[model samples]
Structure formats: C-alpha cells, structure tokens
Target: MKLKVTGQNRGFSILVLVAACLLLLSACSSGGNGSNGAATSSQQSVANDATSGGSANEGAQSSEPVDIIWWHAMGGEMGRAVDDLVEQFNSSQEGVRVEAVFQGSYDELLNKMKASFGSNAVPAMVQMNEVSSRYMIDSGEIEPVQTFIDQEGYDLDKLEPNITGYYTFDGQLYAMPFNTSNPLLYYNKDMFAAAGLDPESPPQTFEEVYEAAKTLTKDSQTGIAIAISPWFTEQLFANQGALLVNNGNGREAPATESLLASEAGMKIMTWWKQMIDEKVALNLGRKTADTKKAFVAGQVGMIIDSTAGLKGIVDSVGNQFEVGTGFLPRPADGAPGGVVVGGGSLYILKDATAEQQQAAWEFMKFLAEPEQQAYWHIQTGYFPVTPLAYELDSVQQNMAEFPQFQTAVDQLHATTLNPATQGAVMGVFADARESVANAIEQVLTGAMEPEEALQKAAEEIQAQLERYNMTNG
Candidate 1:
C-alpha cells in the first residue's frame, strides 16, 4: 500500500512565488502611495550613523517601552513559531516590544517593503530571502549586522560558519542569518530494501544514484522524482566545482554572465537528460509540489529536495514507509565542492529611529541565542544558525527521534567554504533562475538538446545581467 502524501511547495518555487508577490505589490502600490519625509529623514540619519560605525544605542535604555515592527513572510507552523518567540521576547523584557507582522510571503514582504520606502509605515526589520542578498546589499537601505557586532563587541564565533558564509561579502556580515537550510536526497527505506539495495547506505554520487535508480525502477514506480528548479541545478554545479556565473560566482566582483554552457553545466544537463530518457527519473517540470506528492504517494522511490520539507514529509508519510535521507549526490570525480544555504535572513531596515534599530538588534541577538535557535529548529525544521543550538536538549531529543534531520547538518558541516558554495550573487538572479528552469524544461520535453537549451538560457541571462548592471550602476 502506498502512503497518501499531500504536496507542499519548497525552495525555488517559494522564491518564485515571493517574486511574483513583489510584482503584484509594486503594481498595487503605484500612484498615490504617499511618502513621509520626516520619517525618511530620521531613517537616513540613523542609517548614516550605523554605516559610520556609530553605536546602535547612543542613549541609555529608556524607562518606557519601545515598540518595533518585524515584517516576515513565514506562514503555517513557522509563523506560529515566530509568534511564540515574539511573545517570549516581549515578556522577558520591559524595554522593548516586538510586533510580529506577516506580510504575505517573502515576495510579498519585499514588495510591501519596496512600496513602504520613504514612508513611516516601513517595517523596522524585515526578513528577506537569501537570493535577494545582492539586491539588498546594493539597495543602500540596510544597516549591516557587522555594524552592531563591531559596536557592541558581540561574539560572532558562536554562529555556524557555513550559514554565515552565505550572508557575508567582502568580509562583512550584511544580514543576520536565520532559518537556514540545505538540499538532501530523500529516499524510501522500504523501497531501497525491496530493490535489494542496502537501506543503511544511500547513494553518495551521481553514478551510484543512476545505478540505484535503474534497479529501483520496476513496475509503476519511478526510481526518482526531481523538480526542474534552479536551486537544485545550482547545487549540482557547485558539487561539480563549477561556477554558475563569472567573477567567482559573483563573490569577488560583479557577475557579468552565466557559465551554464560550460563543461560542468553540460555534465549536469546530460545526466538529467539520460535519467529521464531511461524512465528512471520522473520529469516533474518546475513544480516542486508535484515532486513531493509523487514521492509521498509512493509513485517514486526518491527525491532531491530541501531539508526544510523533512517535517512535512514525515508527518505526511506517517507509518506507511520509513523515510531515509542522505547528502545530495556528487559527480564521479568527487570534487571538494559544497551546497549553498537557502532560506531567508533578517535585515534591519535603515528607515527607523535609533531606538527602534537598537530594539531590533536586541531581538536579533535573542533569536540567534542557543535557546531560541534550538526551539526554532525543533519547531520549523530549519537548521539552527548557531552550533550551540544543536547541543541543546530539545534539539538533541528531536534529532534522536528523527535521525534524518542530522543529514543536512552533517552535509553543511562537511561543505568547504568557497565561492561556488557561497552561491551566485546577482541582481537578476530571479530571472536567471527562471531561465534555467525553462532551459531544463526544454531539454526534458525534447524540444531542444542540452547544449542548445543551456546556451540559449545563458545568452538570455547575460543580456538581463548587462541591463541590470547598467541601471544599478
């Protein structure tokens, strides 16, 4: 009997949804959406001070309470977790009160943020997606986290390096890492055992994955289900020590063009095409929800998805079949590459009073603490940004109950810090990702060969990058 699994959106799709929301918001907020000059002036002063390494709190802690707004895109259980933490922070102190506001999804939140610029309604702090790091940094409206760290002399060593690495640029931490996640190979233990494969050891390389898929594909069940997403494709490239864009994956300097038609890119596209040709891997298009559904319904034996979906998959699978997880597969060469961090980070907006910024920093520090980090990890299945959170009793107990959760942590720890692993920082990343998805779809649907599809996509992306660089410059 197959387990009836309900589908959920993960990673790349969610980012796309956010981007769409941003567009919708921009359209809605056009015309008469007025600005507050006074607020904008105050914000500019505070931001200037912060950028100049001035203290976050020049004045003493006020006798009265300070209320600040935190706009976030988290929903469902994760939303509830945010509420709980806010309540804790409010109750724990009399100096600050944090108002947790849900501004739709990450895309919507960003949209609202853009619309709120130069207005008093702008949030004091906002949760921005990881992919938006480049845009956010270039926006010139954010007070880097390093400002607070340097001013307060906070201990930055407690945070996980891999998680922090994604938000760091030019040796400065631009944002506070939050709700970090990485991709993993999720498989069915029962299916593997029945296929005469060792359930204890999952495939670690692409070649092994292909052979296992061959044996696992038998009757109605496909061996693997993977969504044609830029996130997964990015991981494949990074694992092969390949650069997605020029200028050290956009870390050393601004990226001018994509390298999707390079040798490493060809290797990935070839493997994907071969898998679908052999009927071993199901072509799920760009819908991550469909891939999740296929895996849950036992229609496919394995999937390449983010660790963020672990809780939902476990809950949906129930007692039907045991779920197993392993690090994402690498190329046959076994190159020393690593996965990039997904999920969003917290950014303290510059359009706020110094008191509000200080209060926001307090809340930020609170969230990064071990206790809060552990609670968040246990509740939402996001990796704790701090290593100490893993040592917490709650995290340890949860890990024991669901050992699958440890795979992502292990993968993150093993990942070497490099430009490829840091991921591409481009202003037109959303468009670039969409283009890559389209290219993969073209290849899978037999409309174009891998080389042709990748080449076309890379050219389009390059054009967009040039336009963006011109405008932003």
Candidate 2:
C-alpha cells in the first residue's frame, strides 16, 4: 500500500545541481531545537569517525595526527564501497583521518551502540537507522547535523525532506540519510503471462491485486507473498487509511497517544484474514531470502519487497522468468499515501573535537554531491536523496539504460503527508511493531479473527504507549 504524504507548500526552490556540471553551496544551522551534552557528544563521535577515518594522518597538526573510529552495519561489496569512500576522502584531505569499521547487521549495531554508551567507549561516528533516530535523539546521545551543515556552508535546500526526515527530531535535524530505500512491487512476467494476466500492466489497486492473485494462484503456488512484519503490511493499511500510530511521525510523536485500533485498521486486518482464508495470499516467514525465493521459484505471483532487492530478484530469476517492477499498490479511493521509507543515516557522535567535526561535515557534504549520490544510486538500487541527483547526467544515463529505476523516483511525486506515510511517533516503536506483527500472525494463521486480533493488538499497544508516555513523554 502506498503511504500518502500531504504535499506541503513548495516554497523552497529545489536547486538542481547537475553533476558533470556545477555544484552549489549554502549555509544553515539548527534552529529552535533543544540540545544536551549527551546528544552533542554523540554527534561529535559521528563527526570524529568521519574525520579520523582509518588511521592517524601523518601530518603537522599538534605534533601528532588524530584518529576517529566508525561503526557501521554495511558488509560485503557495500561495506567495501563505504571503506573505499572513506579512503578516498582521507587520501584527499590532510588534516584529521577517518576510519571505517564493519560491525554487523542492524541489530548488532544497536547492541554495540548501547554497550559502548554504558562503557563510555562510543565510537566517533555511527551508522543509524530511521527508527533508531528517536532513541538516540532522546537519549541525548546524538548531535544535530544542521549545525555541521551550516558550518560547512552547504545548501540545506539541496537535500530532500525524505532524506532529511530520517535524522530529524522535534524541530531539529540530527543525522543524514546514507542509504534510504522504498519498497516496490516485483513480479515475474513469465508467471503473469502464463497465468493469463497482463505482464506489462501490474495490479495498481488492492482489488486488482486480489484478482491477479486469484488468476496467478496455482495448485502448488501461492499468488502473493509479503513479509509478515508491519513494515510491508503497514504500507497496505496506510494505503487504506489505517494508521499504525496516532501521529504522522511513524511512532516518533507521543508515547501517550495510540491510533492502531481504529476502524480502518480493523478493515485492513479483516482483508488480510480473508486473503489467507481463501488462499489468495501466502503468509511467508519474515526471512528476506524466503520472499525472493518464492518469487524466483515461481511459487508466488507478486512479492512486495524493497527496491534494493531488485538485484537479488534479477539474479535469482535469471532467464527462467521475466521480472517487472511496479509501484506499491493502494486502495481505489482512500487518501493516497505513499510507502514508508527504510534505511540508515550518518549521525555525528558527541565528544569529538572541533577539527574532527569540521572534517566530518566536509565528508558529508562531499557525499551529498550529485556525483557521489549518482554513484551510490548506480551501485545500490536506492533512490538518490536529492532532487538534483535525479537531474544528474549519471542518473539520467542510468535511467536510460535501466527503466525500472524510474518507478522509485515517480513515487516521490505521488507522495503525500498522510499519517500513515509520515509514520508513527512513539517510544518503544520496535517492540510495539513486534506486537503488531504478532497480532497479524494470529490472524494469518487463523488463531483469531482479524478484527479481534487487531483490536487486541491495539489495546496492547495503547497499554504500552501509556507506560512509555509516563516514563519518556
């Protein structure tokens, strides 16, 4: 389901920096945002990591070179890509050096961050996810980036809100989007054609999805498979006007508030239950590979997954089936919401020296450049965070070669500021989402009626929200 965003007034003109062309610079800083020593220290740590890099630079500053450490979750080629970028930056600069370290997956990074904080051994810079922003910001462990942007004299307007929002708390911005991605509908053209469905025209609406699923379901096949997590299902419910939380901030607003138990939510769960009962959809395990495998093996007609999964799908499917990309589907007449974004951001850790913070800001602005952004877009299936990145020659050239990349960009134009799309603002969001997922499982497995299951989930969420509010809000 497409989570819609209500389009705000476009008063700020988007500066299109065409790479292989020109670059622009502007200055800004954190305005009207509260600050704490812990948060500043966190931000400094992030800055320190980027500035110190891999090793101590052999320079003439303070008679010795300083070093900063970075802890990140990126691995394999992607991890290498990050290290290479750091290497390039370090080689290009002469002051402080930056070091890149690969820790593990998302969960591991979180654990490490918590442990380091307890030990007062936090790294200089940390790679953080969107959902974790609230925790870091509230913990007073992260520093706002707007100050860094201002000091660096970089154009704030050059970055997009979708990219900026990941790091924003209250009225201030903390982190910067490093690798953000949106979910897209992936289908096997061969399967569609074999099922007598139009390979070119995908199901754009939930009704169409149902029809297509029925037509695509086989004796040994599941027509559609979406992750059992709220990540995927939230999009569907968001598209249908069911909010997972009260505020439009994606569980980042008030812990005291709750909204998941609305009538819209009930309707959404009912539909899911009906889909499972009638065998039109398959409730696959949340294993990422399993979803892709089902699609590649032709066991499922449609898979709603990340655009980042495109390469895996292409590789797995090979020439066995035709692969097609489409936007996330929505209901026919609800407030059209776009999809929730997923990805990580770069946060400056507090406690870094001024020089390191300056150096880190330089690297961030460097990454924001159109050329760097285009390179990232090509290497990964993620959409470029800036509008100008789309206008870059590299991006344009890439779209010419591979058209599927356009779907993600086109969704940006369709974005609206709906509660569903903007996301929830609550404490313990991760835990609350797990509860929601458990409720979904119960419905999918026929352990409970969808309405009852979701209502129960809402009540539980409300209870949690109240507890969190008492403590955090």
Candidate 3:
C-alpha cells in the first residue's frame, strides 16, 4: 500500500510541478478558454442537485451527464489506456463523464495538491502514493472513504485486506487502493545457466542466493546486488525474524516504539557486512532503476527490486537474453512474515461536492473493477488489488503466458499485516526514509560498520518519529 522505503523514488520532479502550476494559473486567468480550468463548485453543485432531484429513474429519461474531473500520474501508453477506459465508462453510464488529467510523478502531484489546498481548487479525485495517505487524512482535507463505501453499499471484503490496511488510519479508511506491488528476485537466466545453476529454479533462500552469487560473480561484477532500503533490508529482516518497529499493528499503534536497534536487527546488519566482506554483494546507490539496469545489463547476476521493474526488464532484455523471476528468498525459518505490498491508492478530496464525490466514486469503482484492474496489472506489472480481477480469463491467460507476473501475486497473497513486514507508518516517513538511506550509503561506502550505521539510523529515525508524533498526535 505504501512504497516509502529508503531510496524509493520520491515524486521528485520539480519542473513538472512548475509547469502544471503555470498551466493552471494561465487557465484561471484566461476565463473564456474552456480548455483546462477546473470547474467551479457552483457549477458542480448545480449539476449534482439537478441529477439528484431529477433522477430516481434517469434510465427512463435522458438527462445532462455529470462531468467529473480526475487528475492522475499515469501517462504514455498507460495514460492513453486509462483514458480509453474512461471513455468506455462514459459511454456505459448516462449520468457521468470522467475527464482524466495526467499529472506528473507522485511527488509532483503531491506538491500540486498542497498548492490547490491553499487556493481551494483541488481536483475532485487524485491518485496518491500510499505513504502520503496519513498526511492527507490528518489534514482533514480528504473524505474518509468508508463513508462512500457505506453510502454506496460496496462490499469491503471485495478488496485485498493488506491493501485496505495501507489506507486505514486511526481506525478510519481514507483511500481506495488502486495498485499494489512488491519486490521480487529478478535474475539473468542466461547467467544462471552459464554458472551451472537451474534457470527454472532461481534462488530459493538467502544461503542459496549467496552461493549462486558466488558462482555468478565475475570481473568488475558482483554475484548479487541489493538496493539498500526497506525494500530489501526490511523484507530480508522479516525473513530473519527481525522487526524494525515495535510489534503490534506496526505504524498503526503509536504506543509501540521503534526496534531498529534490536538484536534481530543487529544480526541482519551483521550478515550484510559479511556479504560485503565476501564480495558477493555490492551496494549500488539506492535507486531501484539503477540497480535494475545493472542487473539487466548483466553487471549484476541478480537484483532484489520491485516487481514493477518487470516492464523495464522486458524492455531492456527484449531478445537480448532470458529473464527469470522468483519469489524473494526466505531464511532457514522461511519468510519472517508475509511480503508487504508497496504501491499507491486514490483518495477523494473533502471539499468536492457530494455529487462530485459520487462521480469520483464511480471512477474509483471502475478502477477496482475486475477488467480494469487486470488491465492495470498487465500494463504496469503491479499486482491487482482485488482477487476477482486475477480470476478473470484474461488475467489467467496473461499469467499463463507471462508467468513472471505470478511471482508478485503469490507473494502478495502470502503477505500478512505484521509490523515486521507491513511497513513503518509515522508522520515523518519521508524524513525517516532519508535518514535510513543516508545510513545505508554510509555503510556501503565502508565509512561505518552496518551495526554502527543502523544504530545511527535508528536514533535519527526515532527522533524524527518522536517529533512527528508530538506534533501530529
């Protein structure tokens, strides 16, 4: 539900934000041009009231449609595909018309939302990363999604439980998870074959990963590479019985404190040190893209990265060599916990009129529909948030042919809502992630032992959490 691991890509593009702002400002200033300006609340109100008062049997009588504005980050072919689906929805419903807006990256979209909050001109609906859900909910600027679910009579159980857990805070649901994914072990099948390993059977455990890496390691090359962050370390720690925070509901319970400095954590770090010493594992900078590219180019034999990297691998290795996907390794005791999902969800803005909310709800439901969710999974390589989608014939067919997609689905269903794996949730997640990333870089650079680096990271993170809890709580 949230992808805020240390070094995870933050919606960090500044230019996109600036350009969006300028475009919006220009649209606002040029009132007569109906191209890009947001709809006025008065306009939306009139439409909603008209639709509500006039339609118990709108199917019997034709009426003007409700136009809902949705701003999203999906673009390129994916954007066009979403737009096509919206068009289909428009044609299917006599009461609603959804306009899909392509905003930039998650970070850029977040900044735009902040700006809109100040101007009282936010979009009716926006897709936000799971990590930022708490802040949006705490601001009281967004509606609790449970209200809509209850009002609309939607079944809560229809969605994945782990996905629901991501958007819930203080026992209230605030977002509808649109996409969810997790890291998988992607390996060069060609390299595995050359190293006398079975390409069909990838690394099943960390011990095997080490041995396979030893075989795959070459000049100016390492056998395996990990992007240092919660993506690798947290899941690995979970496999080894380590918990970074207090055991309970993970970030859900503020009473529980962090345990990143605990014995289990120390053991995890010590093992990382050994891997480094053995020269089987190297720390590439904390970019998922860079590490993924290193693996695709055969610089590294294996990489533990998000399953979302599937597209990149397919693109880079198109007929170049064989690519293999497998579940993340377990320790001797098996996976410490279920693999936590990492992705984003959609939240409704509070200021939107009830009619707009209704319209937005339709779009949200559309996204969650079995067909659309399957399409999203097929396009983005993220897991379908709903199980029914996976049951669709098309989804099953795709899985049968692709095979790689099943790795994420299998791990996702196997995941549990444990604190050790569900991920840390505190107000200063962004800052805390930065602290962890810096500590990781320090350790990988040989400036500090993993234990010392992690200890410093724990102190810094705890301090940030204390300050955030004090202010936000």
Candidate 4:
C-alpha cells in the first residue's frame, strides 16, 4: 500500500532541490527570522492550544482520510522497514493515511525542517536525532509529545524509562521514543581464547579492559580498535557519572560551558593516548567503518560500538570468528553510571493542520505498538523502545538466534536513569561533539598533549554555548 514517489537514484538529488526551493521561499518571505528564529504567531497558537487540553483532532469524525506527511532520515534497509510500517499503518486504519518521505541524513532533515519553519511546507511528523532535542524544543516548531499524551491520558508505562529519559526535559517528554541504542563491547571469541582469556567474561571496567587489551595484543593483531568519535568520549564520561557540561548536563538550565576538562575526562584521554602509544589499540581515525572492518578482519581483539551494529558485525565477520558482545566498560574508580541512549525520536511539527497532527499522532502510536517495535528491532538492530516488545515471539526467536543481543537488553535494564546517563542537552551539541572528537584525534596523533587538547576543545565548546545561548535565551 505504500507509494514510492521518487526512485532511489533521484531521491537525494530531488530532495536537495526541494529543500533549496523551500529555503529560498522561506528566506524571501521572512525578513530576518534566521534559522533559529522564534515561533511565528500561528505556531505559538498551535502550541498554546495543544498545551491547553485541546485535541489535535477536534472536528467530528469524517469519512475522508487525513493524509499526513512524515519526513525521516532512515535509508537502506532501515528505510525499507519504515516504509513497510507506514504501509501497515495506512492499511490498518481507515481514517488516516501516512505518507513516508526520505529526507537524507539527520542533519539534512533538520536543515530542511528549519528552512520550512518560515513557510507552510513543514512535515506533519519528523524523526530527529536525540542530541537535537534542545534545538528542536527551542525552535518552537514542535508540539511536545507530552501534550498529546496528557490530552489523551495515554499509557506510556510500557516504554523503557531510560530510553524515555533522554527526551524528557523539564519533567515532560519532548518527543516520542523511537529508535534507541547503547554502546557495547564487541570482542572476537576466537581471539580471546587464543589470548588465554575467557570469552564469556569480558572486561567490565576500564582497568580491566586495558589489562585485557595488553594481553590480547600480538604481532599482527592489536588488542582493541576504536574510532575517534566524541560518542565514545561521552559514554566514558557518563560511565564515570561525570558531567559533560554544567547546569546538570544542560537538563536543569541552559549550559554555559563545557566540563570536559575534569579529572574523568582527563583520565579517559590519558588512557586512550597510552593505549595508542603502546600499540595496544589501533588508532582508526574518525571513521567508524574502518574500526568495524578492522575488528571483523580479526586484526583487533575487541572494539566498542553501538548495539545497533551487532547484526552488521555478525554478517560481516560471518563464520570467520565468533563475535561476542558485552556491556561497555565502566570507570575503574567510580560507581557504574550506565550508558546513554543514542538514537532518533519522532516529533510532530506545528505547521501541520489539526487533522494532520492527529493522523501523525496515530501513526506514532501505531509505530510504538509492541508488534511494530519488535519488527523494527528485528529488521534494523535498534533497541525496542517498549519492554513489551521483547516478549514478542519474533523477538524471542531473534534473541535465541543471536544471544549477543541479550547483552544490550541486560545493559539497558542495568542502566540507571540519572542525569549523567540522560546525556547533555545543548543547542550546539553537534559542534561540541566534533570539537571533542578533534581533541581526541590531536591527542592520539601526538599533535598535542591530552590536557592541552581537552582545554582547547572545552574552550571552543564554551564559545559555542555562549553564542547559542545569546540567540536562544
């Protein structure tokens, strides 16, 4: 039942052209709204009405189906899965028809959404990355999911609290949890056995990981391989219960500066430098693909990555080496703080009509159903946002086939829903993340001292925060 509007070959180009037209139109219409301008009068009114207990679908039941547009960044197999779900939802309901549109990557989709803010071409629903929560909330182009939940008195008890916690700010959920994942340690079981290490007992702490890496390192195979990404740095800080920024990791109030110059951050960077210098860990630069390939090729004993990579890793390594998964290592000196969820969520745009919003909400709710969630989890290695989805027969079968997936589920259950694990919410989080990654690269490549690199990155983030707060506050 799903209609394909554009062919795969032309989809990206057409989307870019459409986005350009929208941006031009929006710019010509609005004098100086800029990209992060305040909500227009219409948007404000919509927000007010939604927050004041007004139903999105206020009109009486009509025979005409409400068509809603959904812009998502999913591509490849994930995109196909999304289309399948959209088809199912459209066929299952008579009152609503959801049109799913591919809008490139998360950054591209966000750019298009921002450009459409000044015009009326915004989608009824969009999938936004988790780190963009603050910017999305500030843009005022979104109606908080909590508003809809409160109006309908919907039951969200089935959803994972830790997954929901990331999108929750000011005691309210800003977006509906959709695709969620956490980092996990992937090791080569064959390499572990050859190194005289038990594949069943993976390292649980940073010190243990380092010791294991030393033992696993050999002539051709390095102990571990990790990409130079800020994500790993963020995870390490979270594991140590350390703040990445001030103001309770930007949950209590707008963060004014970065806190990456702290002892925990320094410790992680120092350890990373030592690992690379000692040849215990391969410096895979900034490309995750490189690290993944190295690990699958058995050139590295272990690697840390999101649980979402499990299926891909298994398929790539295929029959060559037994791949084992474990929870990401914690800090040696601190209490286990748990891993933060890294995925996108569904947001309803304010520019859409009441009926469109209602239809979008229905689609969101349908997608969150246990069956759909289980199917999504199975198709795309993303964690099921709802606990009930795990009980599904298909999900159980998948777990039986891939016991390594259970580690992710157990890790999620063990994670504490605290501020540290909730992750930092900053308007310029993407830039900040890049700055941290650059700092790590500098340290690993011996271009700069760890302290100097961290200090420079922290300063850069502080400036970005100041600039963002000036316009957003």
Residue-wise lDDT of candidate 4 within 405-449, one digit each (tens)? 999999989888898999989999889988998899899999999
- State in Å the error of residue 301, model 1: 0.6
Better of 1 and 2 by lDDT: 1
Residue 146 of candidate 1: its Cα lDDT? 92
What's the lDDT for candidate 2?
0.70
The lDDT of each candidate is 0.86, 0.70, 0.73, 0.86
Among residues 3 or more apart in sequence or in different chains, the pairs in candidate 1 whose N, CA or C atoms overlap within 3 Å are 18-107
RMSD in Å for model 3? 14.7
Q: By lDDT, rank the candidates, best first.
A: 4, 1, 3, 2
TM-score of 2: 0.82
Q: Estimate each model's TM-score.
A: 0.87, 0.82, 0.82, 0.87
Positional deviation of 327 in candidate 2, in angstroms?
1.6
- Model 2, residue 354: distance off in Å is 3.1
